[model samples]
Target: MSHHAKDLLTLAKAVIDTEIAALAALPSRLDDDFLHACETILACQGRVIVTGMGKSGHIGNKIAATLASTGTPAFFLHPGEASHGDLGMIVNGDVIIALSNSGTSEEILAILPVIRRLNVRIIAMTGNPQSSLAQAADFHINTGVDKEACPLGLAPTSSTTATLVMGDALAVALLEARGFTANDFARSHPGGRLGKRLLVHVRDIMHTGTEIPQVPPDASLQQAILEMTRKKLGMTAITTPNGTLLGIFTDGDLRRSFEKGQSLHEQPISALMTVSFRSINAHNLAVEALNLMQEYAITVLPVIQDGSVIGIIHMHDLLRAGIA
Candidate 1:
């Protein structure tokens, strides 16, 4: 390789090594102050206001989003904007988490007195424990790193990563402390895939009424085949006159019957149907349906309600709805 290429590779490895070493040192820094910071946020009745400037501000935005989605209510505020009018967003019961690698950001320090006057709790995430911002806060979490990943040592590299990880640690600590569950996380993220998996029920996407492919138990196997073919669901439900489900006949059963040389046109569907089958409730989650399908190696399920066949759900339905 050329000298230029070798030099670039060397610099890249050095940067990666520096950042990895910084992360490796972080576990030892998690002390009583970290626990106290978590408790302060948990006890907070109002929102968490995360403020920073420049690169710190960008990381602060993501940290705020993570906290909000994980059950700790939070939003990012620009320290420069807070000095003008955004300070109104801070209230008595709220908690302020300020990010500054140097622990002496001028904009952040400018607003510290105003935050104190509002009687809100302050948690400072900084690289320097003795800096003005850390000394002024109610609690401080030191995110000090041994060195920057930047070759020039001027850019914010390892420091920003450490700050982001510290923010995640705080958010998750509070999440566990508050007993946050997947259901709660889904509620806050209703538009995402996890939300769909947790929130969408079998009834929400099941085919019901005229759309369900079903036949009476005494119907001919040919008639059950016709029903399944017409509905294009690959399976048919056998029910009584009162809409009570009895059994199910699937394409797999047809292949098995043909293997036995059974006459499809003359045999009763009741004789061909599989009485021992798995079914799901209408109220169960769509993910549960997917799980049931995977466990039994089946593609479709009859949705039951109060001992009656209410609807049918196909694997394709869950796939189309983005649940599978």
Candidate 2:
């Protein structure tokens, strides 16, 4: 590497090493206060209100968002704005999480008395264990870092990262305490990939009615092939006279039959259909359907309901639904 490049790498790694050391201190700092914070939030009837100033405010916003998405009712509040009447957002029984590195931010301290008057429970996260904020709070969780990673030892770097990690730890602990599940997470993120995986059901994207390619058990192989071709699902369900699913014939079956020089027009499709096949319910998650398809090495599956073929789901359907 060039001389300048080596210097840049050295400087970057120094900052990373400093931050790592700070983070290593966090695990030993968790005490009774951290446990109380989790318990208090779980028992809270109202939402969690996080407030801070400047860089702490930025970290506070992200912490609130993570808590909210993970099944905790929470939102970020700006301490400076609260002094001007935004404090009206606070209510009785609400849990307050205040962030201040010095534990002496004037903006946050200015509104602490007002918040206390409303019966709010305060949880303070700060670098100083002996600061006024820690003394005033009902509970205290330390996010103290040995030093900042900045060359001047003034920037928020290591301190802010330590605070952020502590916030995530609190949110996740509360999430586990509440028994939050992937389905619960998907509910809060219906537009995200997790929603598509956990919330989208087979019925949501399956082809129903005339769109489903199907033929009676007595139907000729020629007829089944025509139905599969027109439907473009690479397979057709072989059902009974009353539309009960008996078996299915796919392109693979056709390829094998062709190799044997079988008469397509004379043979019944049921003779060559797969009897023991994996079928999924319409109410099942689309991701489950994808798993079934993968396990069986098939590209299409029949949706059975009341012992009849109700719909058909294809691999292309899962791809289009973003569940594949």
Among all candidates shown, the one with the greatest TM-score: 2
Q: Taking the tens digit of each residue's C-alpha lDDT, what string does model 1 give over 1-324?
A: 999999999999999999999989899889898888998998899999999999999999999999999999999999999988999999999999999999989999999989899999999999999999999998989999989999788899999999999899888888899999999999998988999999999989999999999899899987898999999999999999999999999999999999999777777899889999999999999999999999999999999888788999999999998898
Q: What value does the lDDT take at residue 175 in candidate 1?
A: 89
How displaced is residue 181 in candidate 2, in Å?
1.6
Q: Which residues of candidate 2, in runs, are more than 4 Å off?
A: none
Q: Where is the poorest 10-residue window by lDDT in model 1?
A: 262-271
Error of 2 at 144 (Å): 0.6
Query: Which candidate comes out best when scored by lDDT?
Result: 2
